[model samples]
Target: MEEYIVSLNDLKKSYGSKSVLDGVSLHVKKGEIIGYIGPNGAGKSTTIKIMLGIESNYQGEVKLFGQDIAEDSIEYKRKIGYVPEIADLYDNLTGFEYLTFIGELYGLTPQLADYKAKNLMELFGIGEVYHSRIASYSKGMRQKLLIISSLLHNPELLFFDEPINGLDANSVMIFKEIMTQLAAQGKTIFYSSHIMDVVEKISSRIILLNNGKIAADGTIEELKQINQEGSSLEQIFNELTGFNEHQAIGAKFVSIVEEM
Candidate 1:
């Protein structure tokens, strides 16, 4: 039997009478790269927040490594790494200082933290900026630092939300390779992104959510097979998410522009 690393059972969340996640259930096994894609406001961020223990007021059970998250929040959190959509950092601190601070929080020795920070920053081609304040870094540079921090402890599970947001083409390619290698090493990755091509190519399985519910869950080939004969992943996604009016909307926009 395959061991599940993460499990969500009938998860639900609401904000002031508005439901964000409605009876969402899913299981992620060890070594699986789950591409979690959804339309904006489809509860993707909400679900991730609950899983990461950022929001605790939701109803339902979330288990990690066969342990209930609520039962041992610290232990559960220690085993996972998360990169949120927004890269929130202390802009006043230098890259090296920030990473070292994160390492201290993870209980790493100062020497070890410094070594890892330097090595990872060097690997990402940003070692020259290690001593520069974060406020001086570009979007891509800050993103690289964030990635380094997330991997500092080598957690068993990684949750990445729009990780490639400000990355250049080369950095994006490197990130994809890193993800693939991590999965090969039996690390579970729960990736959320708007880049359909990358998700379709990399994900072993895809989960599409709409209106706080899972609309499709399968491999890319399976999803395409379920749709039209030659449907692409984007097509399958559009069909599942009910976003079929793009062509019409585009035409209308063009007509309005011409009238103007």
Candidate 2:
């Protein structure tokens, strides 16, 4: 039997007749970097929150590492790492202090976690801020700390939603390479972002969710076939989501601004 790192069967969610996910089914294998893309309110983050056990009251089965998560499989989380779009940090804690604390929660020794955190911070070019309080760190520095914290445990599967929000160009390049290397080593990665170019380059497969369901799911080349008239993923996305008013919207926004 083929092994799947993540499997969702007939997943559905709603809020007072407003459907967020409608019969979504998927199976992700090891060593695959999946780009989960969609417009705002498309349930992209909702699906991830479900997988991470942060949300509930949905219909369907969610299995991780071949164990049903709905059934007392909480221990499976140890093998998973997640970097959310916006996460709360302990502003009072220093960078190293917070990272080591998080590491301990994941069952790592304080010494080992600090050592790893130190090296990661140094590599990201924020070594000097290692001992600085998180409240004093800049936005980009905090983002780098979150990225490092997620990887400190060396998880087998990872979920990254807008992981490079505040990273600079160089840091973004390094982060992209890191994802490629991790996937090459048989780690699964589910990356959700609005940045189509990064998704196009790093993802082994792309899954597009529009409104509340999987409108498109396939490799980059295969998805291109869906929109044969289009030239890039962005174009294909616009077509799949029934959107092509970029120029019109831009012109209108400029005119509105000039009216003032």
Q: For residue 7, what is the lDDT in candidate 2?
A: 96
Candidate 2, residue 156: CA error in Å? Answer: 1.0
What tens-digit string does per-residue lDDT give for candidate 1 at 49-163?
8888889898889989998888988877877888989867999999989999999888899889999999999989899999999999999999999898999988899999999
Q: For residues 126-179, what per-residue lDDT tens digits would candidate 2 score against the true structure?
A: 999999999999999989999999899999999999999999999999999999
Best by TM-score: 2
* RMSD, candidate 1, Å: 1.3
**Worst 10 contiguous positions by lDDT, candidate 2:** 68-77
Model 1 global lDDT (CA atoms, 0 to 1) = 0.90
Runs in model 1 lying further than 4 Å from the true structure? 258-260
Per-model CA lDDT versus the true structure: 0.90, 0.94
